[model samples]
Target: MTRIGIVSRQQESDLARIPHVVRLVEDAGGTVVAESELRTADVVLVLGGDGTILRAAEGVRGTDIPVIGVNFGHVGFLAEADPESLADVVARLVVRDFTVETRMTLAVRVTQPDGSVETGWALNELALEKVERARMVDLTIGVDDHPISSYSCDALVVSTPTGSTAYAFSAGGPVVWPNVEAILIVPIAAHALFARPLVVGPDSTITVVMNEMGFVDGELWCDGRRRLAAPVGSHIEITHAEEPVHLARLWTSPFSGRLVAKFKLPVRSWRHQERP
Candidate 1:
């Protein structure tokens, strides 16, 4: 029997609904497990919003198991099915009828004073922002040992192609296809006139060196979940991770359609807006 692991956020109702889903999986000749008891599993099922999926991915990283997300909350970008459609989703899974997509992740390392270092990784973006007030922070950026830009801004976002449509897009970055082999650097509310987004090769190394500002420093947020207070003069290093997150996609929904559906975008073409 194949083993399936289920991970959920703090939502007690999602946890409550697991038994029904587990019964569905068990009826199809599979065993269900939880992350705590999951030493080895064939696949993982994530329940909650995008944040929950991100957290669950971290737990399953370095493993070959693919993740299928079930939407229990709003804005579930990673979920494959809604709560009401979980039975059909499990039926599809039982027949091994799904495609898995490998998504690149970013690994970040921060060099602190006295030669100390801190490290983390993010599936969406690694953002550096001003602390306390929204004062502009001075920063110098470099890519693969080459100087890129020097600017003062409220924040800076380093993102992967999978993250291009997330925070980076809101920061005026381009929406890159998920399979694109590139990285994005976007400046937030920058003072420099030339602070436009740049897409670099996947192997390139990106760094952000913060300059000293009055008594205020800045903060670093990973995937908008993990937070770290960064002192002035700290340097952040970002690079593509050696491992990628494998997501089980049961449908071929194009990224364009997802964007339109998620954002409720306006249709400009008369054909789309008008009856045939």
Candidate 2:
């Protein structure tokens, strides 16, 4: 029997239904466990939204265990399966019917000009924005030691392919396929017309340096979890992480289809437009 770890957020929006899902897993002849009760588990079952899954990712970081998410909240991006399909998902897990998608993560390091450093990792994207005012942040961007451009902007986002649809997309970045091995740089409300989004190879290193003596200090946010106050003259270096997050998807679904269904995108139909 395989040991399965169950993880959830504090909100527990579906707290009443956890026991039912646990029973289903137990009936399948697998040992059900929680993060606190984890013990060499083969799989980690997450119950909640993307935030829950992210937390679970951090908890299982550096481990080889695969994580399966059952969506029980709104906008279940990472959590593909719904609560109603918990039994079906569990059954699939019982027989090892699943596909593991390795998602690229971002390893960010914040270094002061004096050489002090702070490090964090993000599955989605890292953001640098002003704290109080809506003023544009003056900064210089670099790629692999080469100077790219310096611009004033409300914020900047360094997103991975897995994070293309996140804040990066909303900020006018391209929707890169999850399997695409690339890094995305999106400027949020850039004041300069030439400041456009750029998609670069995953192997490249990206950096954003804050111009000291600016109007205000900026802030750096990682996966909306870890935070660091960006004092002036701080260097924010971002690169593809050596480790990837293993997501266990029970079913095979096309990315385009999921995007359309999730966003209710309008599709033009020739049949409906033409009268018979």
Candidate 3:
């Protein structure tokens, strides 16, 4: 018998469907387990929006356990199935008819002025934003130990290819395909003329140095889940993580199709184009 781990959104609406989903897993010859036991299970089924899926991913990071998400939130970009199709989803899991996609993640290391270092990881993007909304933060950027640029901005987002569609997209960063191996850096409301988004190779090490002349403090956010204080004279280093998150995909639809469906982009003209 296959052992499955189950996790759900904390909202009342999402919690109401957990009992039904648990029953479906049991009927399919799979034993349901708690989220804490995810490493021991064959697969993890996440019920909720992308936030819920992120939480589940953190738990199974660095492990081969694949995760499948059911959309229960407003934007289900990461979710592979819907709540209405519980029966079909369970059937596919039982038959092992699915593909796993490995997504790159970012590893962050923050060195404080006192010589203490803090580390964290993010599947989406790591952001450095000003703590005071009224004041902009001064940042000096570097790549592979070489100076890149220095400027003042509201925030900076260092994202992986898998994170291009998240906070990076909203910050005017290019949308990189998931299969691409790249890193994106976008400046939010920058005050300099040379402020522009940059895409770097996967092997590069990106660093952000906070200027000590700035009066206000800054904060570092990892995938919007974990946060740390980034004081003046602090150094933030970001690099590619060795272990990537594995997502179990049931459908073989191309990424372009998924993009159109999620964003509802206008494709009427393309649909009517002449075929070769």
Candidate 4:
């Protein structure tokens, strides 16, 4: 029997659907398990939006377990199914009818002035933003040990292709396809003329050094979940993580279709095209 691990939001409305989802899993000849038992499960079923899915991914990081998201919140970008399709999704899982998509992740390390290093991982983007509202942060960027540029900005985001559509997109970075192995660096409200978003190869290492003369220190945020202090003179190194986030996909639709549907982009021209 398949053991399915479930992780849901704590909201009252989100909690209300757990029983129905559990019933579907049970009827499909699967056993339901808590998030703590995720490592032992065949797959994980996440109930919520993209944030919930991120949390689930963090829990199963470095493991072979795959995650399938069911949309129960606004902007379900990572979710593959909806509440109404829970029964069908469960049935499909039982029959092993799904594909797994491996998404690139980032491994971040912050080296403090005292020589101690802190590390974390992010499936989305790793952001270094100013903690003081009135002061901008000074940052020096580097790639593969070569100095790139120095600038003052509200924040800087180093994201994987999988994260390009998240914080990077909102910060004016290009939307990169998930299949692409690359990284995106976007500057938030930069004060320099050459401040622009950059896309680099996956094997490259990106570094950000916080200037010691800055008014205040910045903060490091990993996928908006893990937080750490980035003091002045601190160095942050970002590189592709060894393991990827495995997503269980039930649909064969191309990523282009998913992007158009998720953003509600007008594709009427394609639909109206003439065929010979």
Each prediction's Cα RMSD?
Answer: 3.1, 3.4, 1.4, 1.5
CA error at residue 30 for candidate 4, angstroms: 0.6
- For 165-207, candidate 3 gives per-residue lDDT tens digits of 8999999999898999999999999988898999999999999
What would you estimate as the lDDT of candidate 4?
0.90
lDDT of each: 0.84, 0.84, 0.90, 0.90
lDDT of 2 by residue, 100-150 (tens): 888989999999778889888889999898976857688999999899998
Candidate 2 local accuracy as lDDT? 0.84
How does residue 197 of candidate 3 score in lDDT?
99
* 10 residues in a row with least lDDT, candidate 4: 265-274
Q: Tell me how many clashing residue pairs each candidate has.
A: 0, 0, 0, 0
Q: Which stretches of candidate 4 lie over 4 Å from their true place?
A: 271-276
Question: What is the lDDT for 43 in model 2?
Answer: 82
Clashes of 2: 0
> What clash pairs does model 2 have?
none
Q: Which ten-residue region of model 3 has the weakest summed lDDT?
A: 266-275
Indicate whether candidate 1 or candidate 3 has the larger lDDT.
3
Q: Give the residue spans of candidate 2 off by over 4 A.
A: 37-39, 270-276
